[model samples]
Target chain A: MMDPLLHVKNLKKYFPLRKGFLEKEKTYVRAVDDVSFSIRRGNSFGLVGESGSGKTTVARAILRLIEPTEGEVRFEGMDICRSSESEINEMRREMQIIFQDPHSSLNPRKTVFKIVSEPLIIHEGLRGKKLRRRVEELLETVGLKSEHMFRYPHELSGGQKQRVGIARALSLNPKLLILDEPTSALDVSVQAQMLNFLESLQRELDLTYLFISHNLAVIRYTCDTVGVMYLGKIIEMGEAEKVFSMPRHPYTKALVSAVPIPQAEQPETAILLEGDIPSATHIPSGCRFHTRCFEKIGAVCEEREPETYCFPDGSQVNCHLFKSTALDDEAGHGGGSGKPLETKDR
Target chain B: MKPVLEITDLKIEFDTFEGTSHVLDGIHLSLGKKDTLGLVGETGCGKSITAKAILRLLPVPPARLVSGEILFGGEDLLKKSDEEMKEIRGRQIAMVFQDPMTFLNPVFSIEEQLVDVISAHSNRNGSRKEIDRKEAKKKAVALLGEVKIPQPDVRIKSYPHEFSGGMRQRVLIAMALSRSPQVLIADEPTTALDVTIQAQILKLLHELVERHGNSVLLISHDLGVVAKVCRRIAVMYAGSIVENCSTEALFNEPFHPYTQGLLNSILTFSKRKDAAQGIQGGIPDLIHPPSGCRFHPRCSRAMKICEIEKPSPVEAEKNHVVSCHLYPVRKVKSF
Candidate 1:
């Protein structure tokens, strides 16, 4: 088997909450807790969940943009989570991120040429005409014309701003790019154009992507493997087809079924979860998704936290349903290497 | 079903610094008594403008209605005076906007806002004094419960900031239906909401419309969202109503080139044919759209006629009407 490029093991990020000024009763938000996954070389691994499901937190933790409270982020076999400042700075050159809101991420005052060329100037120390040529080439590569290189972020449309954002991300020629809801802001027509461009760019540049999105359709189109985050925890992770078509965790199934299918009658298998997502500050005791799980059992699911059950394919599901299957086959091959005890934080 | 609201040849323009931008180019649409009519389009396609025009909510200096008549209950709403329009705004028709956060007042409690909405419609016949504070609060509680907001009694005291996006939208829905208006204009009501919350809100709207016998003018950019509740659908492109038909006909057999492009653009869970190809190019600049057909610039099957002259409405099917040169209306047989 080929080596994984990005191995995220048991990543956790907790934000402290202080209610009162006097007593200082502190509680943890548990933004991203116990998320473990590995991206094989040149493959796009997607993280999908609702707004407060902690998808963005996992992405930030992997990039070390926001330092994780616990666990290891091994990039190209080096543990970047605990790396030295200089070592982490070196890793930053290889990994770049394109934020979700282009309107916010890109500097409003910076011109397109300046925005795209700043990375080259800082990283490779290119200046003057050399920097200008590289910036033009980058813009042309992302389907933007050379004329747009002088315009500010505000002057461009939503789609154009996103293209500028892509051009700036690609300027560094990074091996890995984290695209966080890249097309959620654009219209359907513009979103399609952006998505096709991303796919072509991936093949052209041989880039690995950590795609984070809530839209299931976009995730299905872009990702090779998918990780379903629920309330700061990765409830399910597997190949995109396996997870989307036949999701092991109930939360994952509900999410897949929620996306509306076009040119078809109402989906027969629509799993509409009844309640609103609980606040992340006060997460549920046992299973984060047990409150909304369609296939939830009474006692076991609501009591103990489910352990990660690994399949032969290295995909993991944190649910008692798969856990029981493992217990049933405990005698065979000594659990058949289906338990992620080595990587399990719990 | 009796036609409750009708918009005929509705043309509007915005006076920007650059020039006069023609926003809605002769939009023709109608809503039945108890049907959901979805005005679906992409951004900058004049879907929201059409909704705001229906309620006469567009600012006067900026937005000018050049040639159009919004007929509600057989009377032209365009001719209504300011006082008369105010009377008709909340009593006859109510609107639920896109962003629930901004649509609702932050400082006002749920009870205060709902009661204010109830009391503001003072021209509703002799029922003005009948709805006192206590009675209005009771009705607000009942309305909140109808929209499926939990603990209505206690939550009514909480401000809008205390509610989630879904819950805030539900509160807006409750207020929109407070007077039980005949027509409800929901302008992308669930666009800001999550998918799970979106489903719940759509379900709530469906149930409310079913029970109350009201009409919904659902303006949304998403095709699947309006398909969930809308009986009749209209696909708009660059201010023109490209296709209008029953939901089944629109989904099963789309006619216009732009409509076809839109249907193709929807990213399905199943495999995409070839690479995913969307309608090429951004929406046309409304100030000076394409010479003939608005969508001709990006259309795959665009012809010389599509560039030269705009196609009129063609009744391709029993109730389906499309505006395109490709499918000419067949001659009616009288054998």
Candidate 2:
């Protein structure tokens, strides 16, 4: 009911494969092609995909880190893609990103104090005493000691470095945070700690999260809404519980089944997908997932692209199998058999 | 079941600039013939070091094998001569490294690399008849085909750079299996691959190990992956194997606190009611690790004696051993 904190509509980012200077024909890697999702004020929306599925590109495009090729990204009704540099800079105070790799993201030369206070200094222009106090407070908030403020990035462990990264992201008190594989670089125990910490932080700060990760279990644990991306397209988007429990799309089913569950004497029913994901530059025709889709129904899946079908449970799936049921009812916001109200069909 | 490879009290120390890092402190592991045993641990837990020590791959000057015996085929591998070990390296115990790209030579074609592995393995010892290039190439193609690489004849000619990450891993597997080693040590073989690719690789590895009838020591950080393929699981904490048990027993009821914590930490697909839980602290610095039990510092059920004395391995159940003070020693064993 409260307008979604961050709304991305039909976002696209294409990286061109440059050949010669004189070459007229250009080929593009469709990284984030026609992705649309909305995150509520305090809810976490997870974008789950594999290596080249373009989940990171979506996050980058939303932040205008890499300019989107087309479509609207409305952050609290403000057009982010079309905003001026100064306007975007002002908007950045409310939105922040926690990068995937803590080892490379932080400046090696900068101490924990400098890294955490950079945003505060740049935005609010807080002076020496005020800045030191704020940095110490931020470090303490992320479970680091005041003594850790003087330590360099190299001196910190992987888990400690990640804590500092979190501390830095929380420094600005941003309303929306885009976490791109925040715990993938960490060990399992450390990853759990980070996940719980992020959850607690969200509840305490009422922060909107765009959580991007390839780890399905992490997504299922942390996110309220989930989007399953294949190649570049989001084939499935729904409540995390619904999508994970009863995955509609064939790719979603395979992706879910592929994850090795740590259970005792479980059935070896994991759908081992044949071959690797097709290159984004040469994305498959029609349904991008058709090459490896197990439940693919012949010609239609190969010739024509599928439309987003909204179900009664407010879940949306883009697949030919759900076509018959989708056409029976009218289009609506949440409960409908037809196309979803948020995303376009074309 | 007799062990194909048995390591008892294997202690290894690395002489670094800072100090002597006790990387593998009295590690005990046994891989039975035609069995899959997974060594699961965190980054600095010395899983790789243990694997390297089994093959005697660690540099001598910096790496001092403090005390232990690596028994392979009823002989101590540590006492074996350098030339003798070289012969056994690939022919007896082959290893599949984590990154395929780094392990594979960029300049050579897949055919050349496969041929090199095949010929080098066959032409060792000098007493046997030399294997020709033509015979090696033919065998290489068959090996590739065995790993399910489509149209192996043509693809074998393609360079490593041309192949995808998963395909490169398959090539690595093929190379490791070329010699038909008695033992296969895959150190995080599928860690570099995507989830789907990882699944495929895991399945392929399971099938290959079954077909070849070779023991496998799989080193990985993912419990899910180990649970999927391995029959037995070993949980290592800070250079020491804290728990060793059957996969079913581990999943059903883990004895060691570290093993329980590790299992609880893994985020499973099935929705959990409680919030994600983690161990209290990170893995300790191995250079000056915690005395007695390295995990005692971060352990939830740590007692006063855990700080001073190292608890010996106890047989909690049949084929289930745990090194923790909480579980009193019922039956003491060498490992």
**DockQ values for all predictions?**
0.58, 0.76
Off by over 4 Å in 1: A327-346, B122-124, B273-275, B331-335
Give the CA lDDT, 0 to 100, for residue B163 in model 1. Answer: 91
Q: Tell me, what's the RMSD of every candidate?
A: 2.6, 2.4
Model 2 lDDT vs. the true structure?
0.89
- Among these predictions, the greatest DockQ belongs to 2
Query: In model 2, where do residues sit more than 4 Å from their true spots?
Result: A329-346, B125-127, B331-335
lDDT of 1 by residue, B78-111 (tens): 9999889888887889999899999888888989
Best by TM-score: 2
Model 1, CA-based lDDT: 0.84
Question: What clash pairs does model 1 have?
Answer: none
